[model samples]
Target: WKQSHDKDNTNRIKNSTENTSTICVSVCVFLQTILVGDSGVGKTSLLVQFDQGKFIPGSFSATVGIGFTNKVVTLDEVKVKLQIWDTAGQERFRSVTHAYYRDAHALLLLYDITNKSSFDNIRAWLTEIHEYTQSDVVIMLLGNKADMSSERAIRREEGERLAREYSVPFMETSAMTGVNVELAFTAVARELQQRSVQQPSEPRFQIHEYIDAQKEKSSCCRVF
Candidate 1:
């Protein structure tokens, strides 16, 4: 009788495990993050580091229009897929690249800390995001090349000021040393997850409109 009872309990446990897996899969959510910045700011390099875990020096080739890769990550016991798009930063590619920005769940705006001009162009990039993406889209400003502090051209205070002005989170990272790169992405994922939980009734299709409306409200407040 004991042997028969043990077999029954084992089968019940197996079934329970399967049911749990099914429930988790049904609730799993995915997000897409687009990385944008002026050319030569290490956008592609940073992505390659995160996605592939390999770095190729002197492998700098201009991204033609848009390139993408996907990664699966687990955050707070939830499995999430991240589809990352690396876009070309050239002026001529703007028209082609606009579509990639539309449906992005988050944006990582990167600039070289060693180059003052790249740091100064943050406003232009923000304008592009506003034009192409919903105003509620999460934006993270990243100062790259943190490994080259000896050659730093842009002060940390300046980057922080702009990030505050735009109401976005900011961080300094080094694709070479791999500093704060992962943390920046994790912060974005957490923000997206929190938003999803708070507004469970909001349909995914209406997210863009919702964000745009928020942006309009913020802009109106600034005017007054």
Candidate 2:
């Protein structure tokens, strides 16, 4: 289901923190997130909608190169400034676009619900993400254009299934109507915050090796 936007929901990402410590120091964490998908999946729209709270309608031109924006958000009471990189989705820009994935804290693999081919290409994007980004980077599968239900070619179950298979968070959003845009952004923030707590150090998260007896692939993501 498409989630309605409540501007108050932006408070999920607040800058103000409660004073508890005698030496009350402010919290500041920076999370680097990358957005990648097919050419017409509304990636730029999603970013614009979340950052400015206004939807730009009509056929917007594709992002020529990498685009950038940042917003301060609070997740789990921890303040984070999310540096969002919106990468060009065309094949011509793949060489430069995928390079920035390195050292990223989170990745948003987006697909258009109205386009089946866009959803089909998600695995390829996932492959690129695994190749370039940290193995432990928080991944979220976003099926955009939820408001375009009449034209939707991909079912919600399909999105949920893929998300479960890869153990990534999943949400559908409508950049045009501002549906679930805040929730989708904040969910990734909360995930990265929790992961940071579990992994105190930097990018390299220690993943457990699969037992020799188990013939199946590692539930944990790693190149074979």
Candidate 3:
């Protein structure tokens, strides 16, 4: 049902491998996941920490359009490749980012625990996700910058309560300390993997698009 809009672009995308931004690897399954939140909520940092195993504070610029990266993670002995898309949180980029939701397999919505404004914006982000994404897309909420607990403007109980109200899994993560960074991703990936196992007849991937590789800016390259 997904990728219906871009079926015509598939062949051309597959042929142009040299310019693609995704880390191409042969895997049994692929999952398209996206991270959404207000700016400076540590979305890019979290991705870098999860994908690169280290966090470089202040090294990443706000994603101009989108930031793309992929990693192969093993779950239950099955190799699952996660295509992670990071979107710019600015209002100017909202339209550009909304187009991505339709094809995503899962979404990780992040908020800064230290900034109450970011937490307040979560409702708006969730509204957009519901408006654009499919009904089956897995969703998770994360309160980032947990290392700065002293500066936290939102408490863990508030996060947990909001997650309960929304019925999506929630966790507190610190890109600086690598806390729950991997676990959050693993949980999402596991759900996707299990879904695939259960629905063997459904398409394993939603869409395939290749984004030109660029430094300091992300292009939309999706494997699933």
Candidate 4:
């Protein structure tokens, strides 16, 4: 009778362990979304507002290479952990910034609504995406600072046209007023969730290993 009791107790402990593992896995769906754009387009500000619900003004310095933040959000009854990366916009930092782009589940391509040059540079960003990601990567074009319509240089139609040309989603948003910021991220989360449903076995994350492998290969070739 003692042996039988011991066996039953062990089974209960095993079952409890399995249940705990399942709960941990179910509570968070890891998703990586990257924000990329020209300097001064408020990429950092938008992320700060979304993550903290507070707005900070003034001449903030550009990101050096890449900065990351994590937040948990619920979509369609599933809890998801969003890992957001804000990359530097300077040309000299492109090499370092490109390392953050690989395997990203979604990319937010931001542009200042009041800066025509920033809008024009969207093509360059698209080229970068094409170089590192698959066609399946979710790309969203965001016209930020939409509150400054008086200073707006890129019209809504122009932004929409580019988005259509690239076959990506587009939206106008005001980070300062908290307009459409949540919606933009929600749309990205929804897209990722849909993709996850379609591809159940594959997880969504940045391809850090792939970048590391490429760097190693380049260094080896240089030595040869």
Best candidate, TM-score: 3
Question: In candidate 3, which residue pairs get closer than 3 Å at backbone N, Cα or C atoms, i.e. clash?
Answer: none
Model 4's C-alpha root-mean-square deviation from the true structure amounts to 17.2
For candidate 4, write residues 1-224 as lDDT tens digits.
55664466467546644654565476556677889999899999999989988788884798866677777788779887777888889997787667657758889999999999999999988998889876677888999998898998999899989987987778788778777687678677776775667565766543333323433554322210
lDDT, residue 166, candidate 2: 84
- Clashing pairs in model 4, backbone N/Cα/C closer than 3 A: none
Query: Between which residue pairs do clashes occur in model 2?
Result: 13-74
Per-model TM against the reference? 0.76, 0.75, 0.79, 0.76
Tell me the alpha-carbon RMSD of every candidate: 15.1, 12.1, 10.8, 17.2
lDDT tens per residue, model 2, 1-224: 11222233233223211221211335456677888999999999999999999898875799875766777787657887777888889998887677678868888889999999999999989888888888778888889999888988999999989988887767788888877677677767766666667654655422211111121432442211
Each prediction's whole-model lDDT (CA): 0.77, 0.75, 0.79, 0.77
| Model 3 lDDT tens row, 1-224 | 23542453354335423323344444778788999999999999999999988989678878876656868898878888888888899998887788889989999999999999999999999999999999999899999998898898999999989988998877788898887787788778877787767766765532111111111132232110
Error of 2 at 105 (Å): 0.7
Give the TM-score ranking, best first.
3, 4, 1, 2
What is the C-alpha RMSD, rounded to one decimal, of candidate 2?
A: 12.1
Estimate the overall C-alpha local distance difference test score of candidate 3.
0.79
In angstroms, the error of model 3 at 161 is 0.4
lDDT of 1 by residue, 70-134 (tens): 67677778776677888888898887678767888999999999998898888999998999997
Return the lDDT, model 1, position 165. 94
- The candidate that wins on lDDT is 3
